[model samples]
Target: MSDLIELRDRMRAFTEERDWAQFHDPKSLILALVGEVGELAELFQWLPADSAAARVQDEPLRSRVGEEMADVLLYLVRLADVLEIDLGDAAMRKLSGSASRFPPDDVRGQAPEKA
Candidate 1:
């Protein structure tokens, strides 16, 4: 199986072991995912763009950033798993849609449209 599948299975087992599935409904998971993403963003807050990239190469900062990133990914994977969504497939489908919407020739070097 793919590593993401294995990781999702492991997360499922872990949550089941804790009887936490009751707390993992889609809305709650989305909130938790947002919280994790906020934590991850905090690491880069106020840094110049180049400095932010360089910060990840340092010691304690690197480790902390890695932990926050993992938290973000873990929450996202768990959210997808709870919702019975196939993340890899969804990503591929989204990428295909994006490619059609933002044809390279038209969008090359252009800023993304605001949501």
Candidate 2:
């Protein structure tokens, strides 16, 4: 979709602006993703799931979560881009795999692995 390409282009622009193309090679991009995930975790630390839901609307906290999420997605999108992956195709493949792994007729209310 256009949105995906737009995001890819925007991310490229960011790296270009900082002359960070060399540093953003796959290895470092993967590492940066892990760091950003940690930042997301830090924001939710010690919060109960129910309480955590509220943070989604808390401006400052939500901003941190949003940034971290975007960071992860940007790297993932770029990685897929580099690998010539059709993301929509990949997502559909995974969804089909999950459907086989978890048939809706019996998956509901089942325990984690048992599902």
Best by lDDT: 1
Per-residue lDDT tens digits of candidate 2, residues 15-108? 7899888786777877877888888888888888888988678888788788889878888877666667777678889889888988777777
Model 1: weakest 10-residue lDDT segment is: 106-115
Off by over 4 Å in 2: none
lDDT of 1: 0.90
lDDT of each: 0.90, 0.79
What TM-score, over all chains together, does every model reach? 0.92, 0.82
Q: Against the hidden true structure, what lDDT does model 2 obtain?
A: 0.79
TM-score of 2: 0.82
Q: Could you give candidate 1's per-residue lDDT for residues 1-115 as a string of tens digits? A: 9888998999999999999999999999999889988988988888789778887899898999899899888889999998899998898899898898888999899987941
Top candidate, metric TM-score: 1
Q: What is the lDDT of residue 56 in candidate 2?
A: 78
Which runs in model 1 stand beyond 4 Å of their true positions?
A: none
What clash count goes with each model? 0, 0
Clash-forming residue pairs, model 1 = none
